[model samples]
Target: MGESSETSSAPETETFLHENQRSFDVSNDAVTHDNKKSGKPAGDSDDDLTPDDILLQLGGCGLFQILLALIIQSMKTVICWGIGGNSFFAYVPKWRCTDVDDVMNISSTVSPLTTMAINVTDTTNTTAYWNQQCQLPNGTHCSNFEFESSMHTLVSEFDLVCSQSWVTATITSVQMVGMMVGSFVVGHLADMFGRKKPFVLSMAIICLSTIICYFSVHWIMFATARFFFGIGASFFMSIYCILQGEHMLSKWRSTTISFPSWALELNLFSLVVFLLHDWEHVTLIMAFLAAIYLLTWFFIPESFRWLVARNKIKEARLVVNQMAKWNKRPVVNFERMVRSVEKSLSGDEDAKYSVIVLFRKRPLLRLTVPLMLSWLTLGVIGYGVGFGVKEFSGNFYLNLFLFALASIPFKLISIYLQVRIGRKFTSIIAYIVCLVGGLVVTLVQYIDTPYRGGLTTGFALMATAGVGAAWGPMQTMTVELYPTVARNTAFGFLSVLARLGAVIGPQFVYLEVLVPGLLYIMIALLSFISIMCIISLPETNHRMLVDRLVDDLDRERKQEKDHMDSH
Candidate 1:
């Protein structure tokens, strides 16, 4: 049956079901109820409702959903503190070689100097000197250095400058690798066990790892702590979106999924870092804030869709009843209603679905490949522009602030565009915007002007905004494309690719060292490829999510039939 079904369906096209099993079952169950009321032959059972049917009864967008949104939003924002802290904590303040005597006696107090002020012939004279050496080959040099900023950073504390400048960037790449591993592990755990346990455990990991970051006395120790922190943050972020999408109604999905919280965190975190320049203080503060989220253990609940998919009907019913109570709705024949959902879901109990299922079918593989490419572009451009924020011309704080600020409008515009145009077109347009932004930045690198710094920052801000714009639409597309059984795993697969992009992203700065303008040019190329990939995908504007993989293929067949009928 599966082989014949696959051969008949269009390999190039895939679709989400316009109506879900729960909604269809609700209508049939209503007919059964009416037949019973009229003293007619009532066929089958009147209690044939799914979990989503219970959700619809309790009001899809209600107090419970809103509460969960707030919880996810707040926690999502908090995790950014750990993910983004590297920018500030590893910030290399302006420094210069200190004075030394003829007998190798160092001065009690070092001179207040910038890289340009040092008149050393052998040392690199550039203001941004990653390759500058404190000691020349002649040995007539000072190894110790002094920084302009009073606050202690990784650079100042560990003297991670000159020969060690590359270490900071390496740590970020390592963290991205950790995030890749964490997403795969935590996503599988969420699918296998339940969303709540993994979600809460991830939060705890964030809190503890951040504290470890604070107490580290060496750079390697700090990097290790940061790696675990990255895992925790990625775990939390992946599950947060899944939980939000799984709970909210279909209509609100596009608008609800956005980057406002992420943008807001960057904006606020910049101010916090500026106020508290000390890295230790920043790490401690972030750890404390993350710990506060642990208190939300009682408030947050397991995903209803996850529970229903795993066949934990009793637990699903308890959540349903709580949701009903919070939304001020009364349930009738509650046990029967839940039992009907269980029976309907029982057919899939013997079947095991994982990320591998997405590749087992041609239609799903086609859809999955494009989404993976889109996310890879997102990670490359998003973190690529972000990690290089300090390299842009202008004050680091101002650049970070504006870069984050630019994201807010683009994200909002993406939501509006997805609603108006459709997911595929919106994504294509956003990628083109990113491509334009990248080209502008690349152009600035070759131009010579007094306002070059300002120009680079201005155009780079546009690139950041473009990446932000693509996020919301891409998330909506991912959620609407796959079935519940393999949804998080598919997302995890994409996340691993995205993190691979991120691992490559931090190296863009290093690439720039080898060839000027190489960073933005590469970003532009990826953005173009992403645009092409998006063009091949079908629009998923107002489709409902399917619970099983077979249902996804069935929807594709139905769509093909409808297209033929219309012709």
Candidate 2:
């Protein structure tokens, strides 16, 4: 009986091994099948992504899409009304026949008010001139009258009532001021709280304020609504940039960050054309788009990387596991992954000083000064050129479209060049190009006659290329230059200074036509200064982010010693 039992157990063991081998073969085949299905060449399977793998990637793409949608909608609304355009027709009162008759009779009976009333009517009307008697003066009659042909012409041509340029400028300026203040305030709030909460809350405010602005009849109400709108916009911009940067893989971060600005430029071009007819319609469209954020509550996930950094390890593990599952990959060993992450963190700490501690220490002032000056310069020149060009040029919508298109190739080319040629060389070249372009534009403007298309297009291409080359690397450099803890604060402070430039840039454009080129020249000089500041800074091309304060200090000291020894 014992011998029979042993033989039976041996057969069972053989059956178990056969089953295990089949399962292993199936898994291997599935992996190979996925690789084949991905359409990558045979040997490239390891490098190629499967459908499941691409699905896992959609998390960042989804976030970017929502953010881009919000920016595009805001750009449409802001550019439409903020830039000079025809006054909205909704503001025009329906001219009742009774009201018109009463006003005409009164003005005709009384002489002085006749001139005033006619003058107040639509200025486009050639027949709107104040006559001795306002009652259908000779050729001109009320629309109801049989002999009222001139009345139609008058209605079509007249600008009955209009806001002055100063009023428009003041309103726009107030909105920008609100944006400048709100950026700092919102950025701090985002750091203290979390990314998603601030984004949703600000979006709510944006929807509400936009609705209010749509209904507003008076300039004060409009301006006040715009202030709150700017506040909302400020919050969204800061949070979105930070969130996008964190969500992306290191290789993709800069491109994703730059993409939002590109979306904004594209929206500006489209909005300009759309708003030429009706602004209220545009506002309504924006409000509808803003409402899409409600759906994001279901789809958008919090940044997993941020969770890990904040010590929410369990949540981070769950998120990573979910990603693996979604990609149809084997479950990652949670404890092992956590250990690896911790080890990486420790290594980062060894490489750099604590960013938080750096802020408190006085000795780090040397590093802080250069960073601040470079950031401020970038803000002035970068945003200045961005916002100021619209004011200086005619047919700004067309120019903006061309400008955005020109930047696309530049962006592609620059990304390739930066990866190959190194950041410092690319950045310095960008600054020089911008400087030369600005000077060329200035010279063109001063010439006997302006070649409207050629000069504008040429300058635009040059400037766009310069910005495309420098902007991405500049953002990357700023993040790398500061330690992790101070990164947010440093960027926030830099953004504030940049906004200062944004505020001044518009004013500079509005001040005088001749001053734009001069302003661009000054901005070019500032860009040069920014480039100079970077030369003394350490190169951080392939380095991982530094986490600890003391380590950063030691590294810097050692670097300084090395430099001294070399000299």
Candidate 3:
């Protein structure tokens, strides 16, 4: 069956590749013509305006996009398959022919069927049948009976045992709990020490916890591992966003941050596919890969921006010198840059504010409210849809792969829209689309008809676009909106809320599955709330980093006045 499905899918796969190739060809042609007109040598970095430089920009975007997708796919697999034995039953019903009898019959004729039926129950059932039937001289007998009763029981058992909507809700809640605690702890630690230290520590804990999970002897141990895993994950994700923004040039910072998320998504998809067959092996492999990230500490330098912000002028200059060398640019004078940076850091600046000061100041509350709403809504809806991808009726691997592939176009279009239409307008549109899509999904649950496929496809596409738009800009906006000293602290606070939403969103989905359409209604309402919150935000495009709460409040006032004047 697997082979047949793969064969049937070949045409669709080929068509997709052909379309991608055509797009690549057009891009290459444009780059070539631009280079010829400028009379610049290919791959030359001397002139920033050269076509080769443009290609490098595109390359950077692509590299990060691929890596982020890979990471996301890997994580999703671990989350889905790392649960107890009963979780397997939830997925079995989705198989085309799930009856133990039917599987046994199929196994009699096919030796390669072992790959698909890796479970011990499957093997035992098949062996029992073969022994009952006397060995034929020529070949094994193949059963043609459909055995409808067995199929019914298989489906019923799956629905009863593995469909714990309540458990799903509880798991999400626990994840949020971990994220909240981890964000506060890790965020403050990162700020007080440095970005690199927090990142390395988080990666280490993640690796260790994943390893421990493989040997977990009980559900309690597994759940504890999951909680710690969430903490470690939050640390890496938050700190990585900060590092990307601080390291990249302002013009390309958004794209660079956006690209890593795609890799993360892709990683989730890939891990799901592998774990569907061999969960234990895959868990070990994930742990090993995480440990390997430790090597990055050696090569990935500390953020120079953070160093300068903290008055580590010497270290900052040394890191920048390395960057300049790699780029083949002339070395910047360390002593002069240090003096300039010190003057900026120390000159008549407001005393560095603690996290409490942010809440105490009434004016800062305006920024905090919208920021919290955006993060919370984005986390619940964005992550909920991603985690729920396995619920689609089909081959798990194929469904997962398609989901990842769908993101590529969603991301490309969002990048274009973010640039041409501006972030605020594009995000508002995405939120509206998500609201409509959630409504449609709820409506489809009642309609028993052939139109279900169209509804599912629409929901998937809209959700993908909504998530792609929200995830990237939210990270960028969060970092840019706060002062340097309190940036991580503010982000940590928001992360707590966001993780809370994530916990709620999945449980909501499970509830909807139980009560029919409750989750959809909830998501739609949140989407509306998010759209309103987003519209109130000041557009940050082409704006310099504001160093104080006062500056941000004044900017908001001016933006409001400008809006009124235009009206």
Candidate 4:
């Protein structure tokens, strides 16, 4: 539609325009040359147009955006297995020392606790009674173990218990490390290259790593495979959000965050794991599910926002025209619109901004620091409650299913609240809900009622739902707060820090052994901090997206100059 230019401008003086607050219909003429409403001359002031202005003119939530969102959300569903499936993989069954059971002549069905108490006062089997509580009758540590269930899991396969329990916990930690690394590495790749290639590559990694997990011969091998699986999962999760957010209008962005796909997958995962019972089969099934997404490489397109940010206007035009065609509206003077967007750009055609640039800019730094803390706190509590599902005194499968089910309504509620009150307040409200749930979970431990276990599980479920609700609003903020050039990089960096929280989360279970309710107490503290972070952030509910770094920098300087002049 328009010729390309190689001229570059410094990012220091450029500014962005707010999207025109106008909506068009599918059949409306797309030229929009009139200057009556905006008060800017038609061709002369075209440079004031934002991407949102272009989107509204082209029918924002058209068939193309809908199809793209569906494809990306399907990919999100596939990766959810890797995000929370480790709990099932390393499921610890009821077990006791085989030597102690044999020496004490206790029934194999008798639990270790009952065995110890049954023989406490008996004069006979004195050494065996002590052994039931500690070592074997011969004063030697039990070498062999017996499990109640015949199902195959990491615990049953590798005997990861007692002295080896640390291995299970470390498996989860190592996976978080891999996700942390992937958040940075894959994110950089997407921001550097287009979003399509890295997206397909991540799907391949997930499929291959999950197969490796299925065929693992040793505990270390399985753990190593899970680490790679985590990386791929993080890649898909991060990019999909960016892809979906960039393609659709802000109004529809929060609609699909946790419902239909994410939470449904979790509920399905519980049912699948309960039915399969074997870790190998579970991994194989998940791998097969992930492999299906690799075929999407042919169907999916690169994000138009990413293309524009990288100064590929010619490619951006192709996407824009296609969007218009699919929505049944054709641009009359497409070249003029393209030139407007082109003239609006201030950066060098080849110039690129790295994640490091975010810290150097004062305005971005203010947003970045608080967002990092919020994501980190979410990681700690969101994943901590997930990993501790087994520790609750209930049917593990039912507990998992119910936990996921609770998120469905809460996510819907979050969508309503965020739209009404604004993104910042919605996130703060969700975090406050989680904080209250955490406090209840921690306080319930001291209650001596017979229903204390039920109370604990119920409140933990509430906390998880609250954390789940916060994700939609928080992710919407992440997408809206930064320029497209640095959006993926900033998101990746935040996720890397958040993975640190995920690593810490699984270890909370171990800490709870030393001190009950420690996990929820930490969740309560972190949720309050996240609330404070949300409070400091500006509301992004109706603002247009910034496509260039200069836009933010120039705005920051103008604000400072205005402040000084007011004095």
Candidate 5:
């Protein structure tokens, strides 16, 4: 009878939203049941429902959200696979003058066996052996460079080598510009409208862009198509990553966050290089992947957390109940479930966040600059290694395969460490490895040893592994560090902003002609800067995923305000 009386003494309630779970502590002040007939479970102001708690009650996050994250992440990553595709296609293959003597305007029979060698009489004026005299008594250099007929590439077809080579870099940079624009466009829409619409539209746009890219008759045409491709690709990751990650339970969140990389992209790059052997065909394969995502509507729904943040109370409650049912768990009262989420008094809950806020917000300003630069530098490290792979010893395909192979173990280690050591430490070690590994790759050039090929490839692989390992932690850090209200908006804004590095990454290959060591030097510097930035970010390891407008930072400030007022 004493226990019954204790239970009866508690504040009036119908049922706990989650089975076998206690509701948040409520005030003991007697409350009138004015709305009791209306069937709403009223609660004290402290009552807050968290998604983590809701999912825990559901017994599982359910298969639907898992499949949603997997399909979207895996499919969108195909676009990421293609980012390095430019390396193989933009590579300026070895060339020899077609009419060497006639082009030099020399009067003589062209010797079929003309010997050629490099002339570096002046280090600054060094020229290729054949280029020493385009017309070797009968052959001369011309504006047109004739590459070997067996190998095919965009540089070979468009003749973007020599003086006009900047066009190749222009191609990727313009695409980055497009991505930068698209991230904002799609990100705003996703935050305002819903996740599914923008995701589906972006996939469709990707398919259209791929098809148009295949039919390009001129470089400008290809560039225009690539710009649209960038738009589609940027939108895909910016919106989709946040959409998918938000749906995940925290345990699976790490895997979902990191799932975009590993060996998946490099493997695709190797396969495209070896089998497709044609840029046009590779674009078509990307089209097919985009088409597959159109089926996502049948399976995916708005994230429950997103809905709640948006105040779609009815929908959020419905999804949670459905999730519970799907997980073979009991249902909870919608009113009680939602009331358990804490409210924010700092910022207007309905006010929209923009990209500028990333820099303006005091908590975010410090993180924004360093993390964005890291994004840029990591891109250079990743794609720079890709373009320079040919400079390494061994067969081209073999070296590319080995680089891809090296990432698997490091990526696994990264996944394990991000949870144990935390995101900051994981990113710090990865960037440090990148710095050391990049220096090793460049050091191989100065060593002048026969083992240069093995050494260069090995260290290049190290940089590649470090880049791969950093991706998951960086992604998770991005998602978890920001509040849910601004998460997707921030992602969209940052995706494009950081991708500025990704845009320039492939272009580092252009430096191969000027000074090969310069590219590695640039990479090493970027890695060091990124490591410092990682050091500055708040460690987010094992923290409860923020699912509402209530920020711990804001709460602490409020508590300090209350204490001061007591004086």
Candidate 6:
């Protein structure tokens, strides 16, 4: 049939699920997608060959690809998250004022907050030092800070201590601006050029920028470098989800989405590496790791779903066939699968996609808006807990390690609940725990009681782990919720919001110093909003992805509801 006729042959109501398969429940060791039970025929026909099934036919869930993907994700987390948190290095240790002349000084020892004033007298050759006359605001203040033991830090290296201390906040906020910019640029770039290239570029950017940050002589230079680092990290947030072999077998999708982050937080390995080296050395080491990953880029395959969606049949088949060989299976029947894919893709080639269209299209809007909120909530709650490292009662490194370690068991539990209860419930229950945990952390900080310190610490850890665990289902649900035509485009849009959350959420911890209990309250509030958003989304766990929209899903749901009403 001709192109026009082929396009006309498919029904408007029947959308082709091009990527991020959502079918196939896992049971014991067996994972099955029962199409017949869902009212489709038993055979794997061309119409039946979803992106998920094509992956299965061509060996999608092999050990090698999974391990490699996990490694990439892990390094990404360390570079983006680990490095963006430069406050640890910017730390200004104990210091005392030392530049005051002994004859005019008001006490020899002075805190940073203490201002220096010279007593005026005719014999002393008195001169007023206030009102910028002595290059001082109001009264003459300590001109130089003498830090304890000469420990190197950005704060001390360029004098961000005391009056100039706002520089640290300025750098962090600027970095967040970089992250927001990176998301918009990289999101469009990924959807246009395909997934792999932009992500690799982001990794490379992070590698260079982080090292530059380490060598920065001025606080401004450090902030500028950290800004670019933030951009790179933010870009990676969207792209890594794109790279999780979005076409993997249904059962493997959840595993790959959370693997890197899950493993990083669940172990002491990352903390061990961090403690082993100084901040500058750590920056260089992370750079080396990024560079190493860049080399491996040559080995990694581009998203085959992208290839197929763009109608690059020759390339898509080549990749799928290689994947089949890797699994020790016979090559896919290219002729059959290609015909199937081409038919499905014929009309979609001209479909227009833009970030703004999300607001115009209800199908996109319902899921898009709430999913964005959920990501924002995750950013706030996750960082709110993650960065409150001081709250835990143990060695800083051990507490950090334990915070990450705590995430594993919850994530594992989320994985089980995801397969058993569904993404919506799994996420809802997780959020509830997150909110409750934050409440406990907030309340326990006050009112004297036995084991108060330990109890508060445990709840603080739980809140962090709760946010961490919630991420797994949310990530998978998002990818599978949208269509292939606009999947990455949608991701790019959400990427902007994600970075915004990362910037806004973690900063709330600063409020704790001012308001005492306000930090945990904010964390719980965002988590509650996220849970509401999660409730708004339709579950994609057992429903298969069809083309770019939920048209088929809507139709099926209506029919099922109608069928139930007839009884």
Top lDDT prediction, candidate number: 4
- As a whole number from 0 to 100, the lDDT of residue 551 in candidate 1 is 31
Per-residue CA lDDT of model 3 for 1-567, tens digit only, reads 012211123333332222112111112322322355575433232322211122233342243333433443343333332321112222332222234444455446555456455543464345343233222223444322122222222223223232232443454466567777888777777776778888777768778888986786654565577688778877876687776666543345566656534534454635554454544556676687777776667766676656766777668667666665555555544554344344344332334445675576554565688888878887777666655665666655565555556656666666666556656776777678778878888788788978786667558657656766667767777776675566777888888888877777777667655677666676688889988998887665433343323323443445534543343
Global fold similarity of model 4 (TM-score) = 0.86
| TM-score result, candidate 5 | 0.80
Positional deviation of residue 554's Cα in model 5 after best superposition, in angstroms: 7.1
The Cα local distance difference test for each model comes to: 0.73, 0.51, 0.57, 0.75, 0.66, 0.65
Cα RMSDs, all models:
6.0, 15.0, 15.3, 6.9, 9.8, 7.6
lDDT of 1 by residue, 39-58 (tens): 54222346455445556667
- Candidate with more favorable, higher TM-score: 3 or 4: 4
TM-score of 1: 0.85
Ordering by TM-score: 4, 1, 6, 5, 3, 2
lDDT of 6: 0.65
Superposed Cα deviation of residue 347, candidate 3 (Å): 8.6
Q: Backbone clashes in each candidate structure, one number apiece?
A: 0, 15, 27, 0, 17, 5
Candidate 2 CA-lDDT value: 0.51
Number of backbone clashes in candidate 6: 5
Candidates 1 and 3: which is better by TM-score?
A: 1
Question: How do the predictions measure up, each by TM-score?
Answer: 0.85, 0.65, 0.70, 0.86, 0.80, 0.82
Q: Candidate 3 — worst ten consecutive residues by lDDT sum?
A: 18-27
Error of 3 at 486 (Å): 1.2
Number of the candidate with higher TM-score, 1 or 6: 1
Worst 10 residues of 1 by lDDT: 21-30
Inter-residue clash pairs, candidate 6: 16-547, 17-546, 17-547, 265-404, 483-548
What lDDT tens digits, residue by residue, belong to model 6 across residues 229-256? Answer: 8888877777777677465645667777
Deviation in Å, model 1, residue 243 alpha carbon: 0.2
